[model samples]
Target: MTAALPRADVAPVAPAKRRRHALGWLAVVPLLVFTAIAFGLPALAVLDGAFTAKDPATGATSYTTGNLTTSLQGPYLTALLGSVKLSAVSAALGALLGLPLAQAVVGSRSRALREAVLTASGVLANFGGVPLAFAFVATLGNAGVLTVRLGLKDSGWDLYSFWGLVLVYLYFLIPLMVLTITPALEGLRSQWREAALNNGATGAQYWRHVALHVLAPSLLGGLVLLFGSAFAAYATAAAMVGSAVPLVTLQIADALSGNVLVGQENVALALSLDMVLVAGLVMAVYLPLQRRSARWLDA
Candidate 1:
């Protein structure tokens, strides 16, 4: 009876699974660290500074809402509104142009054509900031080659004006819209189209009822993304128009760099907070639309 003691059996743990999980976490660590360093800390600093004011004489920091109040008044408000209008207009124009371009590429029978369009889009979407500003200036400025050749200056076309900025913004915005909406366009199911046709729906009716309905979410999301991109853009406008344009980004730079009124750095932080809020709101709207788009597109 004593020799009949039972031995308990235990399953062996999978070392490979544990190792793979560890590697996955390890791979993510760098990205996590980078995000915290690049975005998280700066955001925190800005938030903190937005609600706190510093005394120039004593260099003492105190909690106050003056920065926020100041940001929403006068020139700051005007700059904010200008930025909003510019972003909205540019995004709308991008959507108008990009949708047709995306459709053209998607509907094309040639794979090479599709690839070429996509490649061009990828390049142009990122063709922004200083280099883009330089390109536009060299091509469209008062003494630009084309401007001189075509006598565009005589037509009162100034490349440093509000409308000019919109055109420059569209260079990047249109391509971004194309890239964003192309996937949604491709996700349109052929069977759905066939079904609509079989049900005696004309092409226009099919688009109005089925295709547009399905594509609306993606389109709206892409527009929101473009809006945010245009809203936050700085370098292009700065390089092209300098302080000629009263953009929020320009104001922020002025405040931070002491190029405008000195000791208004806190105001810059407040401006940044406003920009973040606007961007956050855009993303909030975009996320739900993107989710809805994915529900049908990924199906």
Candidate 2:
């Protein structure tokens, strides 16, 4: 009788917990496979190609620093500079525009205005490539309706110029910056503002002492993201300005699609090298921003 009672007191296995554990890992399996096949393999290919170069005379592929060095020469350098400059300007403009808009959105008493701002931001954030290009062209291009309506001479403005590219890039970039930075701004509590006010601090002083400290890291991160987005953009520039602007992405696309550099693997290698250098620049910006973000969050 005692042995039978002991047997009845034994713990039952948790089938539900086991089933949940199995399902969780099963869900992860597809994602793991997708990452390996899609992102991992291509990334490996790029890494391999970046290091190895084909011999022009023998048509044999081998590793060489020369190809990478040649890749860093004049054209790539010019394009890299242009791309960086364009992206930096776009990010700066976006931040400037975003800050005020974010402030308004966060500070607004009207629910309608906040909803409208959010909706507008969503639409504009996804507005890129050909459609954005055409939007800019329509507003600023020679034959555009706005241009015709304004009766401004074609010589008064050129939407295909480098400045024009900056403007067009900013159109989409500003909304993204707002979306990115607004969360950080809105996350900040009203207590900080009230405390600062109670301490006899001016509005500017409060912003500088409290708000800026809290938001600086996130702002920097958003700038990095924006800069990267604009730097990597190809279609907007191509559709609006063409290769006449001399961006690194344009160079790569030209190598792959058009004359002089078409089907040239070496040039592609060079283009990849150019891309690496730009990537380095982006990382340089991003690392410091991340460090700053960590510090702010810790504080």
The best candidate by TM-score is 1
Reference-based lDDT, residue 276, model 2:
66
- Residue 64 of model 2 has an lDDT of 67
- CA shift at 76, candidate 1, in angstroms? 1.0
Worst 10 contiguous positions by lDDT, candidate 1: 5-14
TM-score of each: 0.91, 0.84
> Compared to the true structure, candidate 2 yields what TM-score?
0.84
Q: Count steric clashes of candidate 1.
A: 0
Q: Identify the leading candidate in terms of lDDT.
A: 1
**Tens digits of per-residue lDDT for model 2, 1-299:** 55555444344456667889999999999999999999788767766776776765787988766656655677866886788888889899999888889889989999899889888998988889998888878777888887788866545777788888988888888889888887777778788899999999999999999999888878888888888888889889989888779788887776666555534555665676667667777779778876777666555
**Model 1 global lDDT (CA atoms, 0 to 1):** 0.95
Query: What digit string (tens of lDDT, one per residue) describes model 1 on residues 32-133?
Result: 999999999999999999999988899898999999999999999999999999999999999999999999999999999999999999999988899999
